[model samples]
Structures are given as C-alpha cells and as structure tokens.
Target: MTKALKASGFLGLAVMMAVGLHQFVILSGGSAVPPWMIGGHAHLGVLSILAIVMGFAVPALGVVGQLRTAVTGLFIAGQWGIPGIVWLGEGFGLTFLMPTGFLWGGALIASMLIMLYKTVTTEEAGGGGRAGVAPADD
Candidate 1:
C-alpha cells in the first residue's frame, strides 16, 4: 500500500505538472484547452491524493490479504487509468477509449466504498482502532 501510495502520489504530481505546462502552452498560443485535459488533470490530482490517504487508512483499519489487494489495485487502476484514457482519447480523438475511462473510474469508486464499508464494519466489530473516537483507557 505504501508503494502504491507513493506511485499514485508521484503520478498525481506528474499530472499536476502537466496541467501547469498545459496552461503555459495555452498562454503561449497553443491550441484551445480541451475539456478532457482540464477534467483529467483535476480527477487524477484528487484521486492520487485519495490513494495516498487510503494507503494510510488501510493499515489503520487492519485490511489485509485479498481485500487489501483488491482495494489497492482497483484504486490505483482508477487513479491512473481513467485520466490516462481521457488524455489519450482526447489527445488522439479516439472516442472509443472513453468508455474504458468510465469503467476504470467506476472501479475506483467501488474500491473506495468497499474500503469504507470494511473499515466501518471492522470498527463496529471491535477490531481495528477508529480514527477520531477516543480509545478506552483500559
């Protein structure tokens, strides 16, 4: 999860930098900024931060094995794949890839929900520690 978080964070940073560069290009008289470019930039940046936060929360919630793998994999895939598909599709005018982007985006959302469910259930079942509720002094 740590490694995945790092990767996502770096990818997010890269995409953000690209957004800046894109702005520069637009300022310097490049082609009009495409909607996909702006949307992808924002989505990737936010999802990357989500991935990092999830990485920390996963261990805190005691997620492990297959559940952990699924959450991590799907989150990372969504973070990278959706924006990538958008970038490629818009950049190359390939509308076919747009559906693929939606699929990945959905997967990312699913993983987040699952993580939330698992964490909530775990805490309810008296397992891992909760984030904010004070621990008993026992």
Candidate 2:
C-alpha cells in the first residue's frame, strides 16, 4: 500500500510538473497551442489528482492483482498520452492522435470506476466506514 501511494504520488507530481512546463510553452508561443490542447492540459491535471486519491484509497480497499495493474497502466498512459497526443497534434498538425488519446482516456475512466466500486464494496464487506487496515480473521 505504501508503495502504491508513493508511486502514484510521484507520478502525479511528475505529470503536474509537465503540465506546468507545457503551460509556459503555450504562453510563450513556443507552441501553436490549439484549443483542444487546453482540454488535454486540463485532462492530465485531473488525472493526476485521481491518481493521488486512488493511492490513498487502495490500501483501505485491499485491492491488488489485475485491477491494480490495469488502473496503474491506464492512469499513467492517460496522464502522459492524453496531453502528449494533443501536444504532438498541435506541434505537427497530426489530427489522428486525438482518437488514440480519447481511447486512453476512456480506459482510464473505466479503470477508475472499477477501482471505486471495488473499494466501496470491499469496505461494505469489511463492515463499515473507514477501511485501510486488513480485515480480521473470520
């Protein structure tokens, strides 16, 4: 759990820093900064927050295995690729990148919902409110 939290925290921080740097590029006219890029920028920022939140939630739910793997991959890819495709598109006029980015975004959203559902249900199974600790032996 600690490992997951640290990894997610670090990832979120990195994405946030990248977003900040990209903002400078946009403001300074280094990039053309298309309108859609604004959404991409926003998307990465929001995804970063989601990662951090999930980091905290994971321990409570005792989530592991395939679902964790899927969430981590999708979150990372979405965080990077979502904005990256937009950046690439704006830089080179490659409109094709948007579809791929959207797919990544969709996967991220689905994985997040899965995690949330698992966490909530796991908490219910464990008998209540908070859930960070492992459940007692039956």
Tens-digit lDDT string for candidate 2 (26-127): 889866656765666676667667667767666667767887777767666766677778768765689777679668778778777878788667744545
lDDT of 1 at 133: 90
RMSD of each: 4.8, 7.0
User: TM-score for every candidate vs. truth?
Assistant: 0.80, 0.67
Ten contiguous residues with the weakest lDDT in model 1: 122-131
Best by lDDT: 1
- For each candidate, the alpha-carbon lDDT, in order, equals 0.80, 0.70
lDDT by residue for model 1 (19-131), tens = 86977799689567878788788878888787778878888778888888888888888888888888888877887888897789788888888887886787444554675
Pairs clashing within candidate 1: none
Off by over 4 Å in 2: 1-12, 18-37, 124-138
lDDT of 1 at 34: 75
